[model samples]
Structures are given as structure tokens and as C-alpha cells.
Target: MADRLRVIQWATGNIGTRALRAVIEHPRLELAGVWVSNPDKAGLDAGALCGAEPTGIRATGSVDEACAIPADCVLYMRQGTDIDEVCRLLASGKNVVTTRGDFHHPAGMDPALRQRIEEACLAGGTSIYSTGSSPGFVTEALAIPLVSLSRRLDCLTIDEFGDCSSRNSPDLLFNVMGFGQPIGDFDQRQADHVKADFAASLSQLADGLGLVIDCWQAHGEYAAARTAAPIAAGTIAAGTMAAQRITIEGLAAGTPRLRFRANWYVSRDIDHPDWDLRESGWRIRVTGDTPLDVGITFPVAPEHYAAFTPGLTAHRAVNAVAAVCAAPPGIRTTVDLPQVLAHLPAQSSAHSSENLPT
Candidate 1:
């Protein structure tokens, strides 16, 4: 514990690169190695993957090779399906901070995988956790503030409207719009499925609200010529964008108690005369005995990618791993962790690890 927290970053995706930068900036964290699935990425330096100078951290496709590196924690940044490897890392006695698929919640995940990690952490005395922006921090922020006021909760809604052309890949855009052919192709695959998208947030919301969810509903919509906007160029066709509207209803012992709606969109079509802004973000409206509405929108473009917000979410998720490693092991929500907000310097004391329970 005397030296910095040795960290291994696996999966060199956008979020992974963001985590790598964060680890580099963090005085307490040390980037030890990098892991990748692409064989072509082997032998490459981790830092170079982000267009930075090499950090002497070579990228390896071999899990064993990466695990051999002296690391106290592993940052998993792959997609949701990559969670199997994350579990393996956790079972290998390495504390994990992953952004990959799975590990979002304890209730719905495979009991066998959960048991393996539980047993592994118990045996290895390490920790494993998953995090991202929507499911990671925003969900926590919504629930924690609510706990201060009334106890009974009714519904929660989160809407994110951001410029996706800047941060996301083309496939992501297609998925948001549900635009691929054979509708089943995009619908059937768990990776592209909307169920996996809101799983974490809904789970976190239910736990935070102290409600049990029975079932939920998700809807996807896309418009080719919905709206129009004038960009730096001439008038550009809007509404040719993709958008999704999601609703999740929770039940308290089979009685409907809470409901949530989340909407995500790309394209200039969502651009309205009233919302004449450049950047995009989120709007969270929680309706209960006392109504509270808070919206975060960006007027101008930010220096970082829009997806970086999710990266921040992922960063906090991995950071949560360190906190849980200090205590017992189980599925934890934002409320269960420390109440410390982002942009604040991490306190060295134990107070940084304490937050509301789910």
C-alpha cells in the first residue's frame, strides 16, 4: 500500500482510453499493463493506443500475461459481452473496475458467475465492480438527493440529448435508431439490444428507491425527415436522426410503485427552436410527493467527446471497485458507495468510502 495503486487497463476502447488518462493523472494510480482481444494489437504500447507516447505498458491478448503484471486492480473497458473475462480477472485475485457488459447488477446476472466472484473475492481478498455514466453516477445522484426528502417514491425519468456525431461510432448510431435491416438482426443480439442498455440504471433506480421491479418496457424510434437545422454548412436535414424512448416500471411486492423513462437521440433533428444549443446532455425529472426537476444541457461544444460523459461514469464505476474492496462483497448501487461527488479531490481517509445503502 505504500506505493501507488498499480492498475492494469484492459480493452483500449474510448472509455478505456479515458480511464488510462485518468489513471495517468491520478497521483495514487499507476498504469501497469494493457489487455486487448485483437491479436494485431499485441506488442503495442498502451500509451500509444491513445495517440500518446508509450508508457512501456505493452498490449497483450493473453489474459495470463496481463495478470502477471504487478497490479492491484484491473480496469475493464470492453462492451457488455466481455464480462466473462472480467469475472475471470476478478476470480484471479485481481480487483476489477470494469465498464464491460454484465456485472451491472447482482439480481439478474448469472448466479454461477456471481458465486464464482463472491467465492473468488472471499478467497483472494480482492474486489470486483462495474460502472458507467447512466448506470454509474447519474442514477446515484438521483436517488441520494431523493432520500433526503420524502421516503415514498413514485417515478423517475432521465433524458439525454447530446451530439453523438462527435463521440460515438457509426454502429452505435445505427443501434440507437434501430436502423439495421432484418429488424431482428439489431433486435435479437444482446449486444445491440436495448434491454442491456438500461439494465444498470433501472436496477440502480429500483434499489435506490427501495422498490422491486416486475417488468419494464422499451421503445425505439427513428425519423428520416423529422426536423431541420442550419449548421455551419447550409440548411441540413434533421429528423433524419435516430432516437429511443425507454420506460421502466417498478413494483413494490408486485404492486406498481415507481416508473422511469429514458430517452437518447442523435442528429440535428432533435434540435428545436427553444433548445437552440450546440452541445447535448441529460434531463432527470423525478416526480414524487415533492416534484423535482433538474436538467443539464450543454450550450457550446465541450473539449472532450460526448461519450466521455459515459467514460466518466465508467471511471467512477472502476473507482467503486476500490471502495468495495475495502469492505464486504456484494452487488452495490450508487447509494451504497460514498457520497463524494465528481470533480472533488479524493480524500485519503475512510470517509471517501461511505455512502447511502440500496
Candidate 2:
């Protein structure tokens, strides 16, 4: 048919592995290379790392090695906030679509870091876009469409609830999220980061609605585990913090108008028994003249829910590759891009040689 866009799958972690699979399966994308940060994963076949059969493309630990490969886009799924590496990728002339939570808005980002990314985009004529399950899909992609139905919208609220017991990443669960820590010892820095990240998402939504936010605030609460329970991360001791609820609000004029709320529980039986419990999902409530409430239920097994979140995150980035490549060189967001849908390729028994590494 037509020439497919060449894509590099960077960092084969939870989200990266899913992005690799999506890139391989899409009809309009070619798997150019795979980049991994772990030294042990270097030189391994992309297929092996992603739980599929060997596909010839090997993972490299060095970003320079991956950047040297000819590619139209890079699906960057690395965890943690690293803006410098993102700028470097854009400077290499490869368009980027990432699941990183930090790049939602330019105003919320560090000014110098934002300037560097803009300079790189201008120099190489490439664009970079970032998204994730919560900040990207639920808040913007899903909420924006629902809000469009309103004739007179006053305020918008988005809530995400997930049971994260099945997630195996210790660093993400206990360390980053403060899952097993005492309520008193919970890390304020992580909470501040969450506030900033979600605030950026809220600001993006405000911009989409043509509303200017005058003030922003963040609130957090923790619920201790009632009893010891086994989680993929580790054993939770009784009375340790097992649930966290965070709300970030943006005010227009003098009212609390926009709200982004997240509720995470390591186990379902945590202190807030009244809290809505489901396999996993998000709810959006738009309040005004015509109040609208929408609930998206992801009815997967609890064990599979952990994988489902990252899989959706990766898919969002992968689906946006073409739009980013075609756009003018700059930082783009969901509000700026056209409707990007999943282009699933037809199933084939024989592997396509076109997807093989050069």
C-alpha cells in the first residue's frame, strides 16, 4: 500500500512494552527500533521483551544509538519526569508521542525546560506530545467531548478510582505513591508533584473551554489499611496508609470551578468504605444549566486492571504518532491535534517483512 511511518519504541517498561505491541500491530506504522534503559534488556529482541515472538529489532540501552536510527516518531514511555531527554529526542528530528504526565501545558512546566524543548523543535522541525491515562485521556480526551454537550457549563469535575494491588512496581506503589508509608511520613514532594501535574491538566481543560483560571489549589488525604494484605508491591502492615485521595482545583474569578480528583487504593477494604469500588474506571461530572454525568467502566479482572491502565496510556501515544509527525514543529496537546483513532491492521498469519529492522 502506502509508506508507513517508522517508529521507535523507547523504554520497554510497563507502558513501553504495550506501546511496542501497538506499534508492531498497527498497519500504518513500522517498527524501526526499541530503546531500553536497563543494561540487561539491551540487545534483546523487541518481541521477546514484549512477550511476543522474535521480531528482529533489538533493544539498545543508549539513547544515542536509538536516535541514530531513521524514524518518523518515537513512542516515549519512560516513567518519571526527565525533560532533558525529551528535548534531546526532539532535537534529533524525530517527532515524539509520550505517556509522560509532565508536558500537559507550557505554563505549568519549568520555563527553561520549556524553552529548550521549543528551541529543539524549531531546530529539527519536529513536534513532541505527551499524554497518559489520567491527565491525557480521562481529563482531556474523554472529558472534553462530554463537556461539548453542555449549553451553559459552570464547572467540570473528573474523578478516577483504581485498585492498584495488582501493580507490581514497588517504586511506583510504595515509594512514589506513598502506599505503605505512615500517614505522617508521607512524602510531601510527591504530593506537590501530583498537584502540579494535575493542575496542568486542569489548565489545559480550562484553555479548551476558553476560560481563564485565576487561582489553583491542591488537597490530599490518606486512609490507613485496616488489616495486613498482600499486594504485588509488598505486604501492607495494619494501620499503614493504603489509600490516597487527591483533589486539584482551578478557580475562575472567585469560584472553585475546575476539579481533578484521583482516588487510589492498594486494597478495596481500605478505610473509606463508602468510596466507590469498581474493577477500574473514571467518572466525569459537568455541572451547569444541563448537568451531565458520565461514567466509564473498565470491567477487567483486578489482576489485569494494572496492565490495562498502562496499555491504554501507551495506545493513546501510539495513536497520536501520525498527527504529531504531520503537525508543525512545536509542543502539541490533545486540544491542538485532530481526532486520532486506533488504526488496527488486519490480522495476518505470516509476518510482514516490511516491519523487520533494517
Candidate 3:
């Protein structure tokens, strides 16, 4: 173990770029290698992909080559990739910190995956942890504080309403929500018990709150422009709108009442952005016994995006770096490791930590 932990960054997208920059800035982590899917990216300088100084690490799509590097951990930001590959890497006795959807579900996730990682950790004597903004930081960091106010657990709720015009890339917009499809067709495709990212996050929330879901249901809503609204590259589906909301109950089957809601909405002017200014992000509300009720809203700021998203992510990455560098390796969530709650500064007065349970 050295003073600075070595890190291999997977993916080269927006979040990946952010994570890469973060690892560069962190005093305790070094960028060991870059993993990419494009053949052209292979053999290229990792720093070049991110417009940073050369670290001499080459970008390659070979997982084995990347894993073979003498590094302590992998800081993963790759999306739509299988957890099995990540699990294999972790099982090889390398620590993994990923933003993948499935790994954050809960402690008992896939029995095989859990067993493999545990075995590796026990054998290698290392640690692994996974986290992100929505499921990672918001669900755990934010929810843990609310726990203090409740004597008995009841339910929890989180809502993220944002304008992704500036943040989201083209591939993400169409692929995730079927954005380009006709509303009729898109609605029909998503009508059934189709699981999504929000479901996984809800599961994480339940796990964080120590609740076992008896049953869960997810819903979606869409509204096209009542009238045409201008957007990048000409009109986009004439006021295209897509939203998904899911609720998972902790109560047993046939229980009287069980309530929870996790929602994601992307629309052009859903709230009429303060055109005079810029405002975006979420309003999070949590409730439990002991009159626990508080709503938090962080308006989007152009300046904050650069630092806020990755800074919060870096905090989680740094927290996971130790585990990823140590013996036990496999996909693990924040709940699996020591809590990162203590590391964050107390929220300002507008957000109180007064009633939290000891």
C-alpha cells in the first residue's frame, strides 16, 4: 500500500470524464489506466481523452490488460454494461467502485455475486464499495440524516426533477426513455411491469432504510408540447415529455398500507425555468414517525455543475478508494462498508440534522 492509491477509470462519457478529473485532483488517488470501447481510443493517451496532462496510461478496451496493471482499485463510471464483468474483476481480488444500477440494489443482491465477492474479500483481505449521486449520495447521505427524526420507521420519498438539456448527451436522451418514438408506441412499450433505473434506486433506498419490499410498482407519464417549443437541432418531437415514477412498499402482502415513491422527470419547461436566471435539480422529502417533514431544493447553477456533480462524486470515490485498493473485491454498495455519512460537513441551517437517531 502506497501513500496514493492507484485507480483505473472505466468509461469515457460525461460522468466518466467527471470521475477522471476527480481522480486526477484527489491527492490520494492516481490514474493508473483508461478503459474504452472504441478501437480508436485504444493506445491513445488517457489524458488526451480528457484533455489533461499525459499520465502515460494508454486507453484500451481490454479488461484483462487494464486489470493487469499494478493498481489497487477500479473507479468505474461505465453505464449499460453488465455487472458480471465487474463482478469477475472484483472476484479477481481487486476492489471495485461502480455507479452501475444493479450492484446498488441491496446486501443480498445476487447470491452468487455476493458469495463470490465475499469470498474474494475474505481471501484477499480487501474492501469494495459502490455509490453515486442519486442512489449513492442522495439515498444514503440524505436519508441517513432524516432517520434521526423518526422513532419508528414508516416510509421515505425522493424526487428528482431536472432540466437535462445542458447535462445529458444525445445517446442517453433517446435510449433511456425511448424519447424519439411516438408517444403512443413508447407508452405501450413501457406499460407493463418493466423495471428501470429508478426501481434499482428505490431498492437501494429500501435497503438503506432497512426495509424489505413486499411488492413494488412503477409508473410513467408523458406530455408532448401543447405547442411547439424550440430546442437544439430544430424542434424535438414538438414539446416531447417523458417521466417515470415508481413506488415500492415495505409492508407484507395484503397489508393495509405501504407507501413510497421515486420519481424522475425530464421536460422542456416543466416548471418554466427561471429564464431570467437558471434553476434545476430536485426537491427531496422524507417522512417517518416523530413529525419528520422537511423538503430540500438545490437550484441548478451553471458554475456548480462542474464542481458539484463530480465533487460529490469524488467524495464517494475517495471513500471507496480504500476498499477498492484492498483485498476484498466485487460489486458492493455503501451499506456494505463503513458509512460515509461522518465524512460530510453538516448541512447548513436550512437543512437540519437535529432529530437524527443515535
TM-score of each: 0.76, 0.86, 0.73
Report the alpha-carbon TM-score of model 1 versus the true structure: 0.76
lDDT (Cα, 0-100) at 104 in candidate 3: 62
Candidate 3 C-alpha lDDT tens digits along 1-358: 3587778888877667766755665556788888887788889887787666777878999988887877777777776756566655665555777766556664546787667666666655455566777656766656666665766665565555444544445566666654433464334335334344445555665666666776655445554544454443233455455434444444445441223344443444432233111234444454546545555455435434543555455446656676545423444555556554222323322212222222
Highest lDDT against the true fold, candidate: 2
How well is each residue in 1-358 modelled by candidate 1, as lDDT tens digits? 3566678887877677767756654556678888887788889887677655568878899977887787778887765455456556666667876655466576676788778667767666676666676655565555467545766566666555545454335454554444221223223343225456465556765665567776654444433425554332233254444343444445556654544445544444542333332346666666677777777764444444443354556557545545655545554445566653333335432211122121
- Model 1 residue 244 lDDT score: 39
Please list the C-alpha lDDT of all candidates, in the order they appear.
Answer: 0.58, 0.82, 0.57
Clashes of each: 7, 0, 10
Clashing pairs in 2: none
Residue 132: error of model 1 in Å? 0.9
The whole-model C-alpha lDDT of candidate 2 against the native structure comes to 0.82
lDDT of 2 by residue, 1-358 (tens): 2799999998888888878877887889999999898999999998888777788999999877888999989888776756777777888899988887667887678888889999999988999887877788887888788888877779898888877888888998898778888877445565677787788877887898888899888777888888997998799898888888877888888887888878888877777787665445788889998798888887566555555556667778888888889999988888888887877778742443223332
Better of 1 and 3 by lDDT: 1
Each model's Cα RMSD: 6.8, 4.8, 7.4
**Quick one: ranking by TM-score, best first?**
2, 1, 3
